[model samples]
Target: MKHYYFFLVFLLFTSCQHFEKQVPSEKELLQKELKAINWKEVDEYPSFKDCDKLGNKTQRQQCFFEYLAQLIQEKLSIDTLSILYPELDTIEVKVTIFPNAKMKFEPQFPKDSVAYDTIKIDSILNARLVDFPKVNPAIKRGIPVKTQFILPVIIKVE
Candidate 1:
């Protein structure tokens, strides 16, 4: 009975260690997915600066809107003002996109004043690599074969 007990304990210990080891197929799949993603070619835009020179608050606000429109066109290849806010006679928008991880857009407002008349826009966008095959030899231990990513975008109207 003593010998049998020792053999059972040894078997259990070895099995636990085996479970802890990473499956070779999973590692390979992750490596391949990481390689397929292209990170160097994304577009970026410069910051808006014209608003600082304007004397009037309303003019400064208009300058902000115009700057945002130009940035969106040059950076994201999207004309947000023409497509989204054509009817508004005067408005301002600001958007920031983080490194495929997060993005935000907000209107520039005065330090001491509230923007009661301006329109606020906020949104979040997310994307991920998916649809990995279950039977691929590169996918070990039933691991999924995709990488996840996130991005954020914001727009403001005045």
Candidate 2:
């Protein structure tokens, strides 16, 4: 009876040890989750106050882009770009919105287009693109993030 009790106790202790599992550390789990996330896409696009009430992600993004393009077109219409570069009708502007709601606009030019004065155009853009309406930064996993997109600004020279 004593030997049988000792064997039973030994079996119970060995079984309990086998059931013990090594839990992963917090840092390891975090790293794994980070790897699993897709950094290229955001849960929500950057938008303006006017666009916030729109339904669905696609509609909100469309409204934001259209409004921004319209504003840019209106602002630049009074500038001297149409007069300075009469042949240039369209300019691809790279717009970047930071997490803090700051914005930057840079005109993208092709490699061989040297006829237009790049410096003058940049100065004009910097000077003209100001005092824009309030913009909300993009959201990624419920956190604000920076976003960049190329906007084709149509310059109606006529």
Candidate 3:
């Protein structure tokens, strides 16, 4: 009877360990979801024009960041608002935009597993100039007529 009990206890312990190991970590799940994104379906947003006129690299960067951020929020709200987990209440997604390219979301995860689950952007949003000055041979442009950008999307999970 004693040996049988000991064997049963060992089996239970081993089974629990296996179950725990089988649960995918938040990072792994997020990465998998991101990888599954179809980049071709993502919509492109208008690019920042006359960035050189901002006069400060830091300010320009911040402006571009904010612009991209808004775009991400709008797109997510329109396209993915319903599909998100109920725990996620609001998402503050950040995005970087680049000239002649797409907006991107950088990977970020909580160091502590308990903090929160991070969902990286599944797809990249392409950017294009909607309105901007035309480069002329006679005029020297102080403001950057064009620039590459990076965007981050922060999703608010409930």
lDDT of each: 0.40, 0.95, 0.46
Evaluated against the true structure, the overall lDDT of model 1 is 0.40
Please give, for residues 6-89, the per-residue lDDT of candidate 3 as tens digits.
Answer: 999999988886666567999999999878865433222233674436766567656655765655555555554335445544
lDDT of 2: 0.95
What TM-score would every model get versus the actual structure?
0.23, 0.89, 0.35
Candidate 3, residue 144: lDDT: 20
Candidate 1 lDDT over residue span 23-73, tens digit each: 579889999988876543322222125555666656765564555455443
Superposed model 2: Cα runs more than 4 Å off? 1-12
Residue pairs in steric clash, candidate 1? Answer: 25-140, 26-140, 65-92, 103-152, 105-154
Per model, state how many residue pairs clash.
5, 0, 28
TM-score attained by model 1: 0.23
Supply the global lDDT for candidate 3: 0.46
Off by over 4 Å in 3: 1-47, 89-103, 106-158
Per-residue CA lDDT of model 2 for 1-158, tens digit only, reads: 99999999999988998899999999999999999999999999999999999988999999999999999999999988999898899999999999999999999999998998898999999999999998999999999999999999999765
Alpha-carbon error at 130 in model 2, in Å?
A: 0.3
> Residue 129 lDDT in model 1?
15
Model 1, which residues run further than 4 Å from truth? Answer: 1-48, 78-103, 106-158
Compute the lDDT of residue 100 as modeled in candidate 1.
Answer: 35
